[model samples]
Target chain A: MSLSVRKIVISGILGAISILLGVTRLGFIPVPTPAGHATIMHIPVILGGVLEGPVVGLITGAIFGLFSFLQPGAPFFADPLVSVLPRLFIGIVAYLIYVSTKNINNILALVLAGAFGSATNTALVLGMVTLRGYLPFEVSLSIGILHGVPELIVAAILTVILVKGIQRIRTSEDRPPVS
Target chain B: MELTRNITLGVYLPGETAIHRLDPRTKIIAATMLITLLLFIKSYEAYGFFLIFTAGIIVFAGIPLSYALCGLKPMLPVLLLMWIFQFFLYSTPDANILFSWWIFTATDAGLHMGNIITLRVLFLFTVTTILTLTTSIVNLTDGLESLLKPLRKIGLPSQELVMTMIIALRFVLILAEELDKIIKAQMARGVAFDRGSFIQKTRKLFPVFLPLFINAFKRAEELIVAMEARSYSGGKGRTKMKTLHMGRVDLGAGLIMLLFTILMIYIIISAAPQI
Candidate 1:
């Protein structure tokens, strides 16, 4: 597709939002204190996937990962690969999930798809991270489960809303207007 | 927990020192050797020698002592928990009970186990951090890609893996910046994120992550089309502008490692085992 003002605007908006949610240290729910909460911080990223598909999703993942790396507190040995694989997986999984389902069952299916995408993301990341010997086997395994459940729940709810919202807009655009 | 921030474990601090300029391949290989040595080190004296050796590298790499130690912030709680668990759970036949509390007993063996294990982790992170801090990401990627290039013959897709790695590395910074912006946007909307109970604060997170994940997918799709438009293909034919080679500095580093290894081995053989 040719370059458009909409693409630029959406990217700038999403980038701005992503940078905001990622750096604030705002969501420090006691349960997962250090890593902070999952929240809707990933929305710009998911939207990136939905709009541009998986490749853009992967690029967005890279952007998100880089954002984490450059934080003042960024760890030196921080592996960008940990961030890339998971987000890339999310993009691919989300794209596939969106395309595969014929009937848009409102928001439920979309939410499930988002959850599965998030789960795919968590598994790949934690898997590589554990391999690198940074995290102990047990903690890494525990994280996979703990982080996975919340991401699923959060992703599911928001994805459903987003999918439906987008669908509505698309339908409105497809409508034939009368004079 | 993948504590994405805790990844500095293997960073090499770049410096003007001799070790910093060694071929990435040599450093990578040497680091592997050092890590392997660490696993075999079972005695306090052995670790002491390892400590001195690593300290030398830290000094050479120009990493501040406190700064190097700070990478453990995220892992501190888990390490402490690990120590606590081992203290209460691990026991041996000759273990002496040092303290007793409500259904919990601390033993000499357990204490030794915790101390030694914790030290191991500390040194482990330290060693790796020094490596990464010293080596630039581009160099690291080039080094790693070249090292893995041989595996390409066996169908490894080395270039793609390296490309993937570099992108991931870039993300650690990009996403943080993104998160920062998103938080501000929500804050502008009067979301008092910091003013709630644990559960309430968590609930507030819905707005934050909803946007983050959605944007992430959007970026990925755009990136893909951008790459395809450039006619990019998988790692079949890629060339390098700079090639890696081990020089005299690496030899010096090897000598240092050899001496350190021998001293460590002797300490392990003679010193009492923490176990």
Candidate 2:
């Protein structure tokens, strides 16, 4: 009962930060493609999911998606469903990957989770925006493909760092438990 | 840590206002309905009424005007970019140019487009923010799950999704608090976080995040064990401790939303099309 109360408090704080970072722009680098903008700020989200589990991760992704949908510049021009549903998918997919994996390195699980979560976010949001017919299909695909490469790479690296680092902490706490 | 400071959604500010006391499901649907109406708001007059109506809600909810608008700080840049894009790309063939520079030209139509679009995004954020600010996280989850339950027939797994959402919403503040602590702990050392080049500052973030990541994973593993101990399973057979109800508040809120949507639709037809 006490832990559940503590978890709720903790969860609220993480959700708030995710929304804040997800909304603020750190200056986007306009790419050659219509929606090309490069920013590496999604690191918190990747960490948020892997650390808090898929539930936290999904919420982070959903919040990011919601923020994007609220943007007037959104290619699909910002529908609420477009903003939210993809994020929801990102969260579920990442967690699903983590839960389904065999007992191996935690780093590997985190990597897959981050990669899948982020990729789902990018794919679903971009697909919905494209459906709005603001830009041509080929153009949107090119943009998605181009930006996806870096997003995936960063997600993979972040997963390893966060997952391994978190595992180390758990083991350290356990070390003193039996003593 | 600092990032979560701007978050106001699903916060449940603990108030005595009428909106605050409304059922969580009612507020959720009211917010959704109002936002949908907002999306179709095309006229200055309609938006004027909306602005007034939104302001009324803010006051009624006991939220300070400044407190509400302050949340837009982080979103300002994106709004500006949207406005800029509208300025350059939205001109019609016969639209009069308001300003002209190198290649980018700002037209009257484009200017209107910018205003309407920006106004829409701003209001959308505000409405949702207010909703979360009043409703508790658990109630919000229950409401969302109840609302989404119909999607189960379509293979939506709405219950599980809502559970994930509830946990996510809860974490927003926790991570922020944790982040602040970790950052301060680092600053206690010789780490000069604020006194370095942009790249250097960013690079120094590695140590801060290193600890945060480790703590987060530990929490997740702990959560997993705790769940197993409780014999927890997925959304299949799970039952709710609290059931949803549609009180008078929902009916009142629903009527208000219907009236607002009707008025907005009428104005949308009468107003000049910005697009």
What is the C-alpha DockQ of each candidate? Answer: 0.10, 0.24
Lowest lDDT 10-residue stretch of candidate 2 chain A: A1-10
By TM-score, who's the top model here?
2
Predicted model with the maximum lDDT: 2
Runs in model 1 lying further than 4 Å from the true structure = A1-28, A32-179, B1-14, B92-94, B265-274
For residues A72-120, write the lDDT of model 2, one tens digit per residue.
3342445766666766666567667777762675667878877876687
Give the lDDT of residue A169 in candidate 2. Answer: 73
Residue B45, candidate 1: C-alpha displacement in angstroms? 2.2
CA-lDDT, candidates in order? 0.61, 0.65
| Model 1 agreement with the true structure over B199-244: per-residue lDDT tens digits | 5776787776655545554564566567677765645566668877
Q: List candidate 2 segments past 4 Å from native.
A: A1-17, A23-38, A41-60, A70-77, A80-157, A167-179, B1-5, B89-94, B192-198, B233-244, B272-274
